[model samples]
Target: MPRIPLVDVKAQYAPLLPELKQRIAEVLEEGTFVLGPNVAAFEREAADYLGVPETIGVGNGTDAIVLVLNALEIGRGDEVICPAFTFYATAEAIVRTGATPVFADIDAATLNLDPADVAERITPRTKAIMPVHLFGRPAPLAELSKLGLPLIEDAAQAFGSPAVARAGVASTFSFYPTKNLFAIGDGGLVAVTDPELGERVRMLRFHGSRDKVTFEYVGTNSRLDELQAAALRLFLPRLDGWNAARREAVGRYAELGLGELCDLPTDEPGHVYHLCVARSAERDRLRAALTEAGIGSAQYYLPPLHLQPALRYLGYREGDLPETERAAAENFSVPLWAGIGAEQQERVVQVIRAAARVPAAS
Candidate 1:
């Protein structure tokens, strides 16, 4: 293992282990495995926390998007506008619903969907707009709302962001292990302000049955299991605190003068800093230097989705999305996690300084 990892899940969960174990034990003793009381209780707590009317727990984040599309009745011959620079699952979910994903350019600074670009991409077939809170920076939801289309927020990276999950027509979250609010295993949810839409999502997650016997919309099986839901209940209350720690770590990186070596992610109050991404013309060199120093690092979305061989048929060429391509080529993520020490951040900056031939921080 590296001296520091990109995210230390073990460290994040260590403090909660005893509580988590007790929760798991209770789940086992209850004999309510799938979509049980724990799942319902978690859904209520999460919905309350997000200030939404309801939340429907599902199998994973990708399914949450698909469920919302199905609930909205968006399907074949429909178009959903989204950013191409995000995780492939965003577009993949749209395609899975038989809707074409219209790619839009992202803002250069926030690395989120540019509302202006989204306006240019709109058409009569545009049924919805999906904006990702990329790297925990809230997307321009207020501007996107003016487009007069349904807004579905892909908030997988930004569970604790202020005013994020509340703005969209519906929002999706992933409780993957690395997330600020995480479960021991995969879990996801869809938050909706509309109770009718919430009921539709709830039914869709459980094989389209309001009751087990009657199938309504031909929905797939995607319920969040009791074990995962129980674990999430333990973590949800602490999400804001964890997000604060992540923000603090980003501030420490800035103080260590890592920003002098490369462009650090913008320090937005709402940004939870899921990944402490930095942009350098020398990203490859910087990553290599960190690797040699026994540190963990990573690069995100190198092909920028539009240029991926799988997406070539979208008729997008190399330069179609300039900002997205630039980000893909220049971005690298360094070690970041809740409770990371200042010394660790300083060491990371020292390696970065050497790689970029910059003076050390005083």
Candidate 2:
């Protein structure tokens, strides 16, 4: 058998080719590439899908975060509280905007930002709270709301996850090719409950231009192009089904007792499994075993951002973030892509189970 892939994008694309091809051809005929009708349509559709008032397309997920922060006027001397256990982009966006990134621990079971810890970390400088729907589980939004700060939902991984709830704040999503609701390439969207804030994001995403020649503020170039927008428009309607398939894979992993050896993800009522991850005491050993067995698994993030050498200036120490440190050491992601087959999933579970049973050295 061929080596089990990490994400089977090709498998998913094969079925959608006819429609995808026609859409590309239509864009070519129009020759109106930048932020054209396709982009507007996608924005509308995505907003409706997310059940938000408005959605603004941008260059990518990172820019989506930065643009929203910009619109909120969060800059120098401000502090944005975010979980340290997420992809670096979460805190990186805060740093880029000249704000300080205040690291908070995540909930051990869900791996989402711990709202209680967030409240503990808030200071006079606190400007916003960025809660990531890590591994497709929404953060504790109900608890975070009590803080009364702007909440930026990092919905990059939880695109179609049912855990997405109205946090009465702005949210951002990544449409990178691998995401649940993806485009052909890099793309992003910003969804906001506040209408005025939504309009500001639109301006910030396009060089802060209010009109063609009228620049209202200094902003970066971060507009989503027409080609990617068209592709996403075609793919959006299928998001729920794709997410359901991923959930089924997760169910199979659970039924096989993989959770006993490896810590399988927990399902909340509203969650949509993005990349089903698990915790293992011997993460590296299990990863090597799976690779040798022709099953592809990945370490989502081996080192938490607080411990990264580049961020030493942030004045963090090893013991400063206990939960983040533990998560970094133990977590690894398995293939839960929409089109991953059951046979492939079985092989993957077998390899992981075998690896987990191996004796650890003292």
Candidate 3:
């Protein structure tokens, strides 16, 4: 069997080659490399697709989160409550803003932030709650909305997910090469429901420039380039179909009954499966087995953020987040891309099943 990649970017690109080539040629001809017409066009299209008034393109997802925090004035001594089970970027963004990350446990079933636990973690210093839609599933938006705290959605894995309007704040998306609605390289965007907040993000992404040459505030250099934006324009319309295919694949995997041995990925109405993950008692072993069988499986987050060495200053200790710790040890993600074929999926399923049936001693 051929080695199956976790994401077949090449396969996806093959079909879009002609259009991609045309877009790149246009960019090259115009010589507008930075935030130009293409970038603006993509932002508008993305905003419409996400059902938001504005979407500001940025350098990457991490920057998107940091910019939002900065715009919200969530700096020194502020406590940002977030689940420790998500990617390091979520917690890292909080720390980057000079704010403290108050770790909360995740729901075992959804692998998302537990709203009850999040509410419990909130103190007077709590300025915001950043809920990550991990692997492609939407976080418990409805439950989290009742708190009335600022909600910065770490929607890096959920670009095309069904929109769940939160009461307090904005949602951030990543267009990293591996994301569901990816760009050629590093890219990100922010969707702000609040007009004033959205305007602030636009300025923050471009060196806090209120005017052409006047810098109003301290800001970072993080703007999405024109070439990537153009590519995204070519790809945006296909997002729904791609997401639908992922859903179909998820259904097939579930029907295979592998969930008996491993906890299958769950959905909540409007999720777009960025990655189809599973929880297993023997996660590490199963991952190794899949690799040996030429199947590419991944561990979404092995070391929960609270347990990371860099986060020691936050005062978190071992067993601080029991649910997060449990998930970090057992969760693994499998290939679920737009270009995945039926044969490849079947082979992946077969290998995983075979791996699961093997005894640990062997």
Candidate 4:
């Protein structure tokens, strides 16, 4: 087998090259690079797709979180509870708001913020709960909502997920090159049902200005540029199709009969398989075998956020989160992407089986 990438970003653009290039050329010819009509049109499309009243485009995902939190007045000594097993962005956003990020343990199966565990962590200072839809499955939104704190969703990994019954006060998404809904460069949005909340995100992304010259809330510049917005538009129409492909690829992985040998992701509705993670006692061995076979694999969050060096000041030691620590130690993802073919998936199974020393079910 030849080399496989975790995701082929260039391959993603190739099928839609003509449309993508035409869009970019139009934007270039018009010379309205920043905060242009393309961005406005894309925002409207995103809102419609998300079933929300408004979607505010921004420079990046982190800024989307910052803007929403700022608009919600969740800064300066507020506490935002989130999972410790997710990407650092979740906690980093909370800290940037001058709020304490109270890390909670995740559900072992879903790898999402565990609602039961969260109840124990709430305090008088706890103002919000940020549940990451880790692995593109909706977080336990209904269970989390019963806690009665404001919910801010980190839907960065969940662009094409099936709809959840409930929504948070705000939800943010990333359009980084590798996401389900990707862009050529950094792009992001804050989606909201409330018109008032939508307006706050819109103003916050543009230096807190209702108009270009006037400043309203001491906000920063986080506008999504014309190129990224244009690129996103080209890809937007194909997002669901690509996600369906990803789902099919994961199904192929399961059909290889590898589940008995490793912990495979289940067929959960709303799961877009952002990473088709599997667990093994032989995690490192499987990863090494994939590397030797010229197949790509990854440990998406190997350390878990609380153990990261930057957050040591929070005083969380090892063994603090048992499920999170166990997950960090045992899971790795296979190369599952929109364009991955069955032959390639078979090769991946070959490598993993070799590492696990398991005979293929004959």
TM-score of each: 0.97, 0.97, 0.96, 0.97
Looking at candidate 4, the ten consecutive residues that score lowest on lDDT are: 353-362
Please report, as a residue range, the 10-residue window in candidate 2 with the lowest summed lDDT. 353-362
**Candidate that would win on lDDT:** 1
Q: What overall lDDT goes with each candidate model?
A: 0.89, 0.86, 0.85, 0.86
Candidate 3 TM-score versus the reference: 0.96
- For residue 202, what is the lDDT in candidate 2? 90
TM-score of 4: 0.97
Per-residue lDDT over 133-220 for candidate 4, one digit per residue giving the tens place of the 0 to 100 score: 8877789898999999999999998897765314798899999888889988899989987889889889988888998888988889
- Residue 96 in candidate 2 has what lDDT? 96
Q: Give per-residue CA lDDT, model 2, range 117-158, as digits (tens).
A: 888999999998999988788789888989999888888888
lDDT of 1 by residue, 194-260 (tens): 9899999988987789988889878999989999998888888888888889998998898888888
Worst 10 residues of 1 by lDDT: 353-362
lDDT of 3 by residue, 71-181 (tens): 998999999999888889999998999999998899888889999899899899999888888888888887888888878898998888775434438888888888888
Candidate 4: residue 203 lDDT (0-100):
91
**What local lDDT does model 4 show for residue 44?**
92
